[model samples]
Target: MLKHTGRRQQILVALVAFLVSALATVLASTVTTASPSVQPGSDGKSGSPGATSTKPSAPSSLSDPRKPLPIGLAYGDTLTWKNDQELAVGLGDAVDSGAKWIRVDLSWNDIQPDSPKTYEWQRFDRVLNGARARGLEVLATIGYTPKWARKAGCSTDDACPPADPAKFAAFARDAAKRYASQGVHMWEVWNEPNIPFWAPKPDPAGYTELLTATSKALRQADPQAYVLMGGLAAVGTDPSIAYVSQGDFLTAVCKLGGNKVVDAISYHPYTYPYLPSAKTSFGTAMEDISSAQGNLVSILAGNGTPDLPIWITETGAPTNGPGTATDGKTIPPDTTHVTEAYQAAIATDTVQAAAANPHVGAVFWFSDQDTGQAADKQHRSMFYGLRHFDGTPKPALAALKAAILAYEHSR
Candidate 1:
């Protein structure tokens, strides 16, 4: 995802420049991948023990609520980070192009690097404020265990509670309390907790416990704020692997009394090379997620939480593969590398899918711009953003604008 050269860098400079802006919690114990044997809470409600349901005002129309924009978040720990200014511009672009919401990750580890007393709100203030200023709601992800809160042998991004469960819970409570004040309401407890991305060995039971605890903290902080279950990564391709299949993870959670714990289910359906439909081959990038979604819904229904919605909180298709083409051209997909058309079509499709799916409440495209994380930064790779590596918009940019116009007109 690295930028090619000076010309490329300048082309994407606007996105990077605006980013000079903006900027989670937890608990712990012996984290094992064990499963609870009892049936899940199917009492038609969700809350910590002895807590009662306090439903928020329902949507104007449940029939076909305008889905949230399938967009991206400005993630941290990367070289090409996004600042508040860049985020504002990116969100403005998305809003102008018909996006209803924007996803922003509020890393628990980074925010509470030490203790709840050492909370950091400056970074997030910029991002949340910027997006809101442009009329975009936030789908905030609140997770990432800091080194201090993790257990022993937790070497990588994935691992258990940094130190203890109480500390994690404190962090979670503080996050809910603070964000609630900021008006950046929707909250996702963690990111793919069922996978190694959060925990090395798919610890479904342990994650359920984490979700339950975090959900309690959030509900206490702000009854009005929406709390979504973390999206599970697609793990259906192999049963024997250590990863937890998103479907199976849901099933396990349902069994562990997790049905009434959160408001909705979130997911990361990273279908690469974009399949035209979910019925594509198993190997097809997003096909597995499409398939997993089917199974997950069934699991939810069986647990009697069928009314809960699904949010493709994160989803996108890379536009940079050699075999890739938008409407059928072999050109590159970024501003510098290719025309704006490819990027626009990809953005349009992301919007189209989000709008079409009735079950999906939101769809935040994976990013605002590429941060040059690795090699092979395709014209439309993750490193490939709406604008070129420099500050120019590719075909995708303009295409997205047209699609947004059509979307608004449809209303």
Candidate 2:
């Protein structure tokens, strides 16, 4: 998931960078391993409690009026910003791309940058309302501690955990309460907490505490919401650099009862240099999601949350780099970089693979459109859109749309 080396530079501009997204709310005090229960409000008309084993089949027409999509068919996009017009155009484009869901940041710093009591709801509200108007479901990733929320003289990246997690829980409750009625039920705690995104260092226990508090606070505000643990970035253990393998980080959290408190596990299983279908010796990417015996599914099962659902909150491949081959598109490379053709292949493989696996509740491609001529430091490449920066649609987007339509209707 660490596709860009300049991520630190990117973080300077993204006050609400990737939220580790540990989330929760009206979840039953004790969750069942196989299918977690959601409140009636969360399910909308379905009014079902637990997640359905088989997702509702997709409508015949991709562009037809999209009913609330089933989780299994929950194809989505991770968006960086939600300006007024972009929602209508960008999100509208998402729908055209066969995406029914959007995972967007609800930065705590942006909302309450002034003080604990001060709040600004106008901009965030536009996202919720806009998505609702377009019938696109939203998963709000809430995190990013404000300057005041961090300890004094704390000069770490915005990934710093709040000095008072309780304060963040309050902000989460307020945000959840304010948007629940406006049609936002999915909440992710933070983004990639298992990496440098957690700041000073990645602390599963600290993140667990924050998720627990935020989950409890959300329960009070909106009993109908479904909370997800922050999306764990796929990485190996490297204490020398303050990194913990996703397996170790999650195992530690599950030991602390993190698995028992939430409805589903959020993960970012980004398979780039290799396509999702590639058989690699290295145990990373899609293998972390399902292929390997030690993937998220088995990990949660062994740790006590057996058959728990996994929402692939972020996954995609970069379209350009030194790795690019002639003919303008490269195949998978030896490094984590891949060409547009291969990236398009990933877009197809990811959707088809998720459809074949029931444990995957959702898969949101890392972007909706491109931001740079090619992914680089300035654009925060990780969240680049599926299209070219020039506004020309990439093969990845079309591939994703066709794959979704095929998977959904076939079901």
Candidate 3:
């Protein structure tokens, strides 16, 4: 998922220029696949020892009677690599756009590169502190195995799960204790574990173990913290590869008792090319997340927890990027790439659809801004941001803001 380019250097120059202009005016701000798994391992029956049996339950609404449904933005690794000033601007834009929450990765490998004994908090400190300064809540996604903690023979890949779940739990516990008071209360256990890229091979029992350990540790450190299962990548079944469908993965995890430890199930239902409401030809109606939500609910209920909520942690359509259009048009000339107008329309529709669903608690757009220069980046996925990489607003940004405001007002 890492791309090398001079884009960061370019962004740095743009930020510097913007900062100078703001100083003149006294300030300113700016902003996985799976296969028909050999099924997720179920330890025989539900509620069995080490298996989750507690019925899934939603957080009590009375707990925060006045809190509004959250609209968040996935800020990616920006905080981990960007400077303080860059972060401040990005966060400020999020606040301005009515984003109630911002998700950032808290990579274990980055924080404890050498050994568990040596922890580096400088980068995360700046991100948490910067977000707090902007009056924004943070959803810290904790994951990635350090080289020392990875299983034997595994490359130094962050996606590899640690050989010892307790070590991962210990890191999570430390993070929870360190950031509980910093206005970072929500924690997502990992990122797209359903995909092979995120996990060497998708294993229900293994992910469940990681989730259980991390959840328990975080709870012990901060009882009030909300722990969410990492968002599953939305894709259909394909037997040839080692990927599992989101539905099957959810079923296996629940059967293995994942529901007992998690507060909510998270997913990234990116329906690119097709609108969120469009039905996919792939037998399953997952292209429309609302349909997927129904499937998720049924799966959870059957596994024992029927009352859990779904958090759409990431989803978006890129307006312009390196990709062919569904209509078979080449993207760059404005003939093939998804039009800005279409992106805005779909964004608005997607948010509205999520808001209408009672099961959905939060909807976080894939990003607040696009990555790299739109013209130079080879990966179209990097263009999913609501704003262009250089900080210019896209129509989707306005659409998102409006959707958030409308949803809040209606509530």
Give the candidate number with the greatest TM-score: 3
- Per-residue lDDT over 1-411 for candidate 1, one digit per residue giving the tens place of the 0 to 100 score: 454677688868866665543210111122222322212222337454423333433211222364233334423233114665665566665665556666666777667666656867776777777766776666677777877678778845534554565566667677778877667557787777667666556666777777787777766777665677887776563545567677778888889977678777887776544432334434432443334445666677889777666777665545444545454223235322322354455567666665665555555665545545336644444554555455455565566667666756666
Q: Candidate 3, TM-score vs. the true structure?
A: 0.79
lDDT of 1 at 129: 72
Candidate 1, TM-score vs. the true structure?
A: 0.74
| lDDT digits (tens) for residues 1-411 of candidate 3 | 134457777788999999888776652222112222120112233322232222212232222334466778887677688776777768876887788788899999889999878988997998888887777778889999889999887766879989999999999999989987775668899888878756567888899998988887886777566778898888765656767878888888887788777767888887656666655455223333345454887777777766566788888776664453543122234332466777887678777877666667677887877777856555666777778888888888888888788877887
The Cα local distance difference test for each model comes to 0.60, 0.69, 0.73
For candidate 2, report its TM-score.
0.78
Question: Candidate 3: which stretches are off by over 4 Å?
Answer: 1-67, 279-294, 322-337, 375-378
Candidate 2 has an lDDT of 0.69
**2 or 3: which has the higher lDDT?**
3
* Model 1 clashing-pair count: 49
Q: Over the stretch 326-400, how does candidate 2's per-residue lDDT look in tens digits?
A: 221344344435557767887888887665566666778777666566437233464346766666777777888
For candidate 3, the per-residue lDDT at 99 reads 86
